[model samples]
Target: MNKKTGTAREAPFDLAAEFEGARLAARLFGGESAGSYLVAGRLIRFDRLPVGDLGLLTVGFRITDRPREKWTRRFNQFKYGQPSAVRAATRTLCAAFGMFRLDGDPRVVVVSSVPSGQNVVRNDTPASKLASALAGSRGWEWLPHHVTKDRHPSLTGIASAADRDATVDGKYLAAPIGGEPGLVIVVDDFCTRGATFTDIARAIRESNPGWEIQPVSLAKTERAAYWKGELTNAHIPDYLDAAWRGDPAVASPFF
Candidate 1:
């Protein structure tokens, strides 16, 4: 009787279970299990520092209505920005740092490049407002960075002359300003090309030299492409099984 198999001759491989085991494997590695991994299909920890008072600088993007504009008028009234969602996501990210007892009292900085002109750092767009509001609710201070130039996909530099991708244009302009030291986390509503973070990393590494930049998102199209490995039954279970075998490396938490 193979213990890994069931007797019904119809037992399906539990994906959620496999995922959990992998997560446990991550924990065993002394990795700081972030709450962001709770719903994320893939999780990766980029840096581990040994010190006090960590800072999390989040490069943010605007979240817009989905399902195309033709259908937008039907639900525009109910499609306003929701602060609850922003706070929940923020807490999830914060929890990840909290899990490993790394640093809880973090100073979060929200940097935006949505072209809202004016120095409305404290009171500009919804995203900035949400970030400010989060800081207020958590009793943590918020730092806002907003830029407003004639920059977008339609601009001259940053992207290809023939490039029609709006997202890429936004990223190109945003990267220069967002790249900074002290545990930076770049977040977007979704990622299609993975260029924004890459550019940010390039800028930061060029300027600061050794700072590690982590890229995070609310929703990604597929885990396999961005992550190191492909998503498969073998990948998850193999790691988990190796973890349960008391691998020394697995036991070493991220430091």
Candidate 2:
């Protein structure tokens, strides 16, 4: 308690505790499940699973509400080589990967795909850059341009999953053998219908049948209708309370 204000002092943010609370709330309210998910229609297996049950592994930064002005700005900053944004993005990756116990390993390869012939000087491939940084931090190998997009598919404009899948040319998308056989984590910035990731994972697996493949992203659209209900809102205070306590679980993953 603060003597001057005669009220209890607020505690610092606790990441782990907040995460646990969020997990509990999700369980109670029938929200997003925690842990990695097998890519639909793919038989590739992983020796280690990530912390989400969705079709792909993801680190939830925030609810991806459409017209997310803040997220847009941060993504732009990260794309344009802003130091603070890079650090924050890197931290998020570290946190998610760490939670899945993926750090300090040589058996994992982080791969990112970009449009072929894209100008690297103009920072056109932001996801690749982010994936490379994450790999370096984890002491893992990074293939920034493992797969190449033959044509510029406007993924954002494509509404249907089938259309998105049709746009991806598997013949043009290629993943080379990286000398070592291990799990390959395909990293991307955003996931909508997951068509792009699915195509990439398929291409990699077809090329290297011995390697395990999985797709991970920083943010994924919340497609579950249950997330829109009042239960999510009701648990906000609990998450906030856990955050204020500075629980180790709530601590920043970058630290």
Candidate 3:
């Protein structure tokens, strides 16, 4: 505890969580669990431990390898804000972190949002339900926070970087979280370039310093770039660590 501030300091990495989280991610990606997920096309998985200031970010669903193909109708269903689609994606995300054990009464920070193109949009996306489910999970005391909102236009997964940033800039709309800095999980339904997650993380960091933040997205669309070298098990953790630290060798394929 900080004697003066009387708040807990940032907890060190739960190397076990990193090891296990990476293992689970690799397993899911290596296998056919993520239907229509092509390893060749995806770059960042947010499976590694939080690097310096950025937390781990993982998308629940992956964009299909082909433009016409899909993991299922769920992507379309999700765009329509269908509950079943949200639940399925939530389960996938929860499954990924189901075994991740952490310390303290970590708060679940949810960023509920909708696509601008949708005829109908609901604020309570998978993030709300995921937080609820996570509260009962991992045998940890999970506190739910007042939800954040994007209430903005969702991307078509085809926007240029400048355009995407412009559309998403200052849209994070910071919500002050009052508590001792500990652990916070930021959840979103879909991420492209993770602009929302990045913005949200910045807000939380500014308001709640020393808190370990992890961002989880239900789905993400990214450009394709396959790893030419072998990403063997023996080197997963080290490679990820290096990647997070800006190592081109690992970042080339995984980040």
What TM-score does model 3 achieve against the real structure?
A: 0.56
TM-score of each: 0.38, 0.58, 0.56
Candidate topping TM-score:
2
Candidate No. with top lDDT = 2
Ranking by lDDT: 2, 3, 1
Instruction: Write the number of the candidate with greater lDDT, choosing between 1 and 2.
Output: 2
lDDT value for model 2: 0.53
RMSD of each: 14.5, 9.4, 14.1
Q: Write model 1 residue lDDT over 65-127, tens digit each, in one string.
A: 233322122122222445544433443333322212113333334443232233233354444
RMSD of 1: 14.5
lDDT of each: 0.35, 0.53, 0.47
How many clashes does each candidate structure show, in the order listed? 5, 13, 2
Candidate 3, 2-109: lDDT as tens digits: 999896643344533554555666686763332222221111244432122343445333434433434424555655668666655444444444334445445544
